[model samples]
Target: MKPEDNMNIIFVGKRHEASRVLSLNGTVAFVLAVFVAALLIATAWGGYSIAVSQVEAREPSESELVAEWKRKLDEQKEELAVLQQNVQYQVDALTLRLGEIQGRLLRLDALGQRFVESGLVASDEFDFNEPAAVGGPEDSLSADSFAAPDLTRMIDELERKMQDREQQLRLLDQVSSRQKLEDELYLEGRPITWGWLSSPYGYRSDPFTGKRTWHGGVDLAGKEGSDIISVAGGVVSYADERHGYGNLVEVDHGDGLVTRYAHCKTIKVSVGDVIQKGQVLALMGSTGRSTGPHVHFEVIRNGKSENPETYIKRASR
Candidate 1:
């Protein structure tokens, strides 16, 4: 239909019909169409085969995938171990705290029991299981907030009180003992009491003298050989006859008190011998400067003479 389509060729070698003009346009177009169609079909089939082979060569299978999962499992296991260790630490901390609280409870219980014994507080007031009483905004806090080391402090207070009580008891015992000792001293240690003086020092009637006369000792009337007693606790100063006193006895009492027993029928104690109150010294007698048997007694304090009658009156009590 166009000028380009008019190009032609003749096939002359086969026969007279072949010697006709040949149309190249139609044959060429047809061959070109066939070549293009074949190239497109072959390219599409090759691309499809390449895509299928890539699919067949795809990544690992289930076994390898499971190995990877196991790796992740191991990591998680390690993480769990660390978490368990942390949990154990927390548990230890809580256990320690619980132990501390239990110790405080035991202490509180002991303190309560002791309080009941000492009559300081009631046992019911210190129950540990009950909620702590709140005295203020933060009174329910730890033990330090209320009663801490105050537990042992009460021991000191009680010790002081006990010492005071013991001291008072000792004082009472001492006073009672002193009173008893005083009674004994009054009864036994008195000089010249409840007894008559048979002789007095430095002048007295000699019963022989019938007339008033200067004498060295006064005669005292008593049954011959009666008991002659010491008036106080002391050592014997002399126990021998000298001049008018026959078988005389003398005692040196402390604090300058002295007594002489003259005309003793017999002497019982010697010099430097300790004697207690009411101890027998000799028998009563009137052996020296006497017309009849009698005893003589004398009391001199610090070399000053007092009436033996006065001393005898006091000793009677």
Candidate 2:
């Protein structure tokens, strides 16, 4: 190599005690440059490898990622199933409630029909067999779906109908009770089922003493042991022997009205016994002051004896 082509390098010690000189030709310099470049490349490559290792430690592996995805899918499926079950339960409960309401409505209809048949209300006015008449102009905003809210509204409407029916039934009951009271209080008909009026009220000749006396009641003669019925519905007040009566039965109707059956062979009712009209009170016989099988029937109003013939002539209710 030529002297000019060779390069000189100098090295100095830290203490400046000694120095060294080196000479490099073109082939050697090229070799040294190549070695330095290879060292730098190796250092850079090592740094890049460390950075990739750190990133891999921070992130999850492929298996872990797949497991996490599977768990999330299972959880979502469970939530969906729970939601579906809840929706089904709600639907079933609403359907059951609707069925119960329908049953109640049917019972109300039956009751209303009975009231109508009993003549409490006019059949034309309250036709329980037919559905209620309802009509309206179709609204543009009408609902198309029978959702929970629509079901709730229908239940509310049914409850309102039930309230209306209950109110009507209460009124009918009141009317029926009043009519029953009137029928029990109004007195009519004869004391005996089969008999003839042998004696009347006012002046009559006494059979035992043959003397003219003011008779207070009428005498109905019948076959012995015939039933002596009550003329009205009342409670029995007396059913024992009296001064001129044997086996007597006295019934007190309401409103200060009463009836008496005397000279009975056998008393069939006791005191305080509530009885209906035409109920047997006793059996007719020749007892007490009676001369034959007869019943002394008398009606009293407000402590005054009334003419029994007037009540007997009234039409039966």
Candidate 3:
């Protein structure tokens, strides 16, 4: 027996035959129902997804977030502005205080300058900003240079000047004390008080004689028998005059100061009598060449007869 032909059942893709039409129809119907149901489900799912996407898209956008950020930025800007204003105010106040301090410093500097000019404070011997110099030759500053100096050196210079001023003040006090001592020993007068001026110096009419004459002294009018005091402490230069200045007494105060009193009712001092300032010299009266009771006063300096008024002011002061 020959090998039987292998029973082969091969199925290939083909369209449906008409002999099994019912079965074919039933399968087609089932497939169509399934396809329709799947289509319906797919369409429903796509529509739901599109609606959800639309809802999500309708929520707050980036523009709204950007607007919120802008508002926050504006608030921060306001806060920054407030802080800046506070800082500026503080700075301005500080600047004002600095200006006031500078003004006070300038005034103090001016006062220091005046003190130096008045010889109350001594000034620095050398410029602080200049280079060191010593002994013999004088050196000059360079015109083109701006100098930076040591603060320690300037402080040292100030201290030296302060010491010098302290020394000067001590010497000034000594001189003042010496002057007061000499003034106490000198003879003086009360020229302004106790009388009124009646006559001036130079040529004038003689009041008693009614004649034109040169007046050698000034007349101090006061009541007769008024106190006539010595002008200075000195020995009696001349108690009796030769003529003109009748009943006159002259006292020679040392150091070129002399005083004379004339026209006295009675002389209390003699030729050799030593007189002190404020001691009674005579009594005022119309004793010689006078119209009314008065005192004739004269001051001679350096052998020249000066006006008594000038010396009278000094003595009164």
Top lDDT model: 2
Model 2: colliding residue pairs = none
lDDT of 3 by residue, 62-127 (tens): 999999999999999999999999877866765665576556545445545555544445567533
Model 1 Cα lDDT, one tens digit per residue, 1-317: 44245456566765555377766676575666689999999999999999999988999789989999999999999999999998778667656655765565565455445445443446577653467776756566566442323433544465566556556645655565555334333423323223454455555544565666544333466677778787666789998988977778988876787778787788889899988678888887766755666666667679976566555557433
Error of 3 at 253 (Å): 0.6
Per-candidate Cα lDDT values, in order, are 0.66, 0.87, 0.69
lDDT of model 1 at residue 232?
A: 64
Question: Which stretches in model 1 have alpha-carbon errors above 4 Å?
Answer: 1-205, 214-218, 315-317
For 58-113, candidate 2 gives per-residue lDDT tens digits of 97989999999999999999999999999899889888887887888787787777
Q: Rank candidates, TM-score, best first.
A: 2, 3, 1
lDDT of 1 at 137: 65
Ranking by lDDT: 2, 3, 1
- TM-scores for candidates 1 onward, in order: 0.39, 0.63, 0.40
Model 2, backbone clash pairs (residues 3+ apart or across chains), number = 0
lDDT of 2: 0.87
